[model samples]
Target chain A: MTERAVCVIGTGLIGGSLMRTAGKAGRTVWGTSDSPDTAEEARADGFDVTTDTDAALRRAAEDDALVVLAVPLPALPGVLRRVDAVAPTCRLTDTVSVKVAVADHVARYAPSARFVGGHPMAGTAESGWAAGQAGLFTGAAWVVAADDGLDLDVWADVAELAWACGARVVPAAADEHDLAVARVSHLPHLLAAVLAAVGAAGEDDLPLALAASSFADGTRVAGTRPELVLAMCEGNRDALLGAVDDALGRLGAMRGALASTGGLAATVNAGYAGRQRWAAARDPEAVRVRRSRLALPALREVGRRGDAVVGWTE
Target chain B: MTERAVCVIGTGLIGGSLMRTAGKAGRTVWGTSDSPDTAEEARADGFDVTTDTDAALRRAAEDDALVVLAVPLPALPGVLRRVDAVAPTCRLTDTVSVKVAVADHVARYAPSARFVGGHPMAGTAESGWAAGQAGLFTGAAWVVAADDGLDLDVWADVAELAWACGARVVPAAADEHDLAVARVSHLPHLLAAVLAAVGAAGEDDLPLALAASSFADGTRVAGTRPELVLAMCEGNRDALLGAVDDALGRLGAMRGALASTGGLAATVNAGYAGRQRWAAARDPEAVRVRRSRLALPALREVGRRGDAVVGWTE
Candidate 1:
């Protein structure tokens, strides 16, 4: 069937990005915001938007539009309940970070809507509609969760939507998605935060001043919005905890081995080899040929001056 | 006193870089190598080079040249003893990551030579003569250690050498420098290693494939030369252990709080704030102006036509 109008219920980063992508794809897009100021901002950005959620959902239902819930976790249930009251017959989807909770809530509150969970693995630490970009999800993995409560045909449509926005569709069970993300995303964020805190909480700012590219890269995620990060940590608490424990056990072993045998070469080598292999596998086309070095002219002129024989400029 | 010709007793990344910088500064530089092949490499790169240690030291002595011990930590003592036997009157310095050991070794093995410990805080995972660059030390902090046995005037000359190479000379006590780098450098390496190992040791490579910029950044140091990284960890063992413990305490508290209180916003916020302050303090001149986003023109025209509702050529 031809694509129908998409009602984006929240126009923050993810939703705004979806609307922008959909607009670029020549689809009719309607958006709503949590506040009048945001609604005004979205409208100013050329979106057909409003602060009236019930009216928007009812209009979406009347038009047989696809409704996308793209609000924060704490706000999802109320939105679902509102959707059930006004737009139950319309097919629905969501862009939430954690899937298991979203699946459960969708089942209980909007059972009449055929729903699948989506999580486009894109975006920066910055949020809000202001942070949105038309190409936000391009080249990213947009997870189309196959939650048992979700419908197969609807998921195909959801996957198609993801593809339309230039994302690779990754099908996964809700719990599996949550577990994978907790390990890949949440655990790293927590560790980075701790690392940054360690840098700041030191005897002084020496560590911070001495923090080069490596330290900055290692802790970049720690500088993200705390509220959003805390939400992910809370939502995937168990899996994140497991990942933390696993990493800590290995690191503690590395420290002990360093103290004793003067060897952690095995671990370091493994990591180096793994990253090389992973990079090769992920982008086979980008592998570079071996590079050559050194071919210059020779020179030597010797002289002596003082006890400090090497030249000093200042 | 006029600066004299210098002999560099290794031709790896750091040594080659120093030779290149000194060459650019119009000093006659002679470089030694572990083997003939490396000496050839240096010669091809336009360096006055030698493979014979005694021959190199004697040449340095005859010219009243300064000597830079640019070998690995394990190789330093032997080179220092060789300097004592052949060029004892020539003042000396070294480019080793750790400092206290270098200070002690200099005191014991090269008593007649004025010695100062140095560490140019620059470089990448790539090493050897092939990785050398003329401006490697530019904009970097080149630590000049104030070991009790080290001559103050020799250090001033050494600091001037660093300055002439376009570096900012940071004067510090040997132990203090060791402790600071332990907290900043070694600890980050350990964490990145463990983090990369965690990514590799997962159930599959999905985590690796999905590893984004954050994971890549956080684990970058893990991809550096395993042998060199191993040396840093082992050389700075005591200070590294202290940093590890301190970071673990904070991280464990974060994990525990995440598991129990359903509230870690405070800790996350603290870390976020810390990174911002650290970054601002680290590069105050580079602070960016705030940017605004989005005010696109509105448009919406929705309809459906089969799978073609969204145009797809694939």
Candidate 2:
């Protein structure tokens, strides 16, 4: 079967990369950027990019192209409103960092759109069309929302797009994705911020000057642009709260142990074991059942077992 | 004047590296390792190494060599006892990670030794003599203690050795050095451990597989051996407690803002600014005042201002 056409709205890092990847994979791909400069850059790079979202969505609706919302969280509502106005029933998914918030926005603004939330767990600490690369998603996990009562056809379409972009699909509920990212991504960002701030609190430059590999690695993400960090951390506030609480609980116990015993054997050993497990974990074997054998429950079970959807047979 | 002879009491990563660095700089250098395997490896590499601490100390006393106690915190007292038995009045310093604890150990066990605390803020996670490299301390800060009443003659001897090994000397008080490292080094290790454990708590590979640069960088140091981490964190308990308290306070506030207002602007912004400051900082200009113009207070003031001692004039 010929690949479905792709319509990407917002040709910055994620969107521009996806457009390039899909086009390179032989799909009919076009994208729109709110920044005319970015659109021009993408077009100059031989991509079909424009500054008109309306035209992009209308073309997607007419050609049955997959519409990918690639805007940041703060820009999601406006883009969804445009999707509602131009292609309310278009096959849609997004590349936003937070899922449940985007799902809620889709339900409110583009109610009839066949939307499945997605977040490609890949990126560099860079922005703009210039930073986008065709191979960015290769070997990365692309999470696809598998919330119950969803259309499997649209779900498969999204997963196919991810696979076409050289990604493996991990099926998860929107809420679960938010929670997982909160633990792995969002909480790390916040902790990095705190760590960086504390390191600098000395105001003497001694600590900063003395900082070595550990300090650099721990605060690496804290160097990300504040606005981007704010959007992700705030957008997933509910889930991040839970993660923060968990970290705080662990830290509190660690502090108590240190104060009393002067030994961090427990915290250090647990963390050491955790790191070892992370090193030991190879990806679970990929799964490919027939389309008839797959459902939301099976997909979720595969995700819980840490397996990725590699393909589906007839 | 010719360079003084050097003797290192540990031949693990730091000690072995220092021995190589000193020997390459034309200093007469030899070392001892508790591990026979490590000592054999060092000896096979054409360096003078042994497992006999008593013999090493006796040789140092006879040659008046600058004796570097490069053992871990737990091994400091045992090594110092050997120094007391064979070389109680020898010129002494150490490369232990913690400053105050080592100072206390030296005072109690080798009181007559002209002692100065030292810690070269450099290393890799890998240990053992084979992992040591000659350029390990090149351009790194080798902190030499400037505590009150410290014999400037012995302090100068230690600083001269650090400079001879290609490191710039940062003179700081033992307590001050402890506090500084607690913020930049030890604290970061603990936080990395917590972050790693929290991330792995999911008991599913999804978070680990989905983890990208942020997670990897944040938890990088947690992959170090737990015993090493415990030694550093537990050895610097009082200062680490203060640093951890500061981190927890900031985290609590961040959580409050996230829970109540759903905005991490304060934490994220402070962190961004902190990271910006770190990026903007250049190594401070080196100072080389005359020996007559330098004292413990003056050296510490230079350290507080983040300056390094590149040399000293007659």
Q: Give the alpha carbon lDDT tens digit for every residue of A69-164 in model 2.
A: 888899998999999999989999999989999999998999999998899998877878898999999998899999997777889899999999
Each candidate's B-chain TM-score, in sequence, is 0.86, 0.98
lDDT digits (tens) for residues B95-149 of candidate 2: 9888889988988999999999899989988887888999999999989999998
User: Highest lDDT: which candidate?
Assistant: 2
Q: What are the per-residue Cα lDDT tens digits for candidate 1 across B153-269? A: 565567567766787655566776677787677777877877777766655444554566667777778778888887766777777778888888877777678778867776687
Model 2, residue A17: C-alpha shift (Å): 2.1
* Model 2 clashing-pair count: 0
Could you tell me which residue pairs clash in candidate 1? Answer: A1-B306, A2-B304, A2-B305, A2-B306, A3-B309, A297-B46, A311-B3
Off by over 4 Å in 1: A284-314, B1-4, B284-314
- The per-prediction tally of clashing pairs is 7, 0
DockQ value for model 2: 0.74
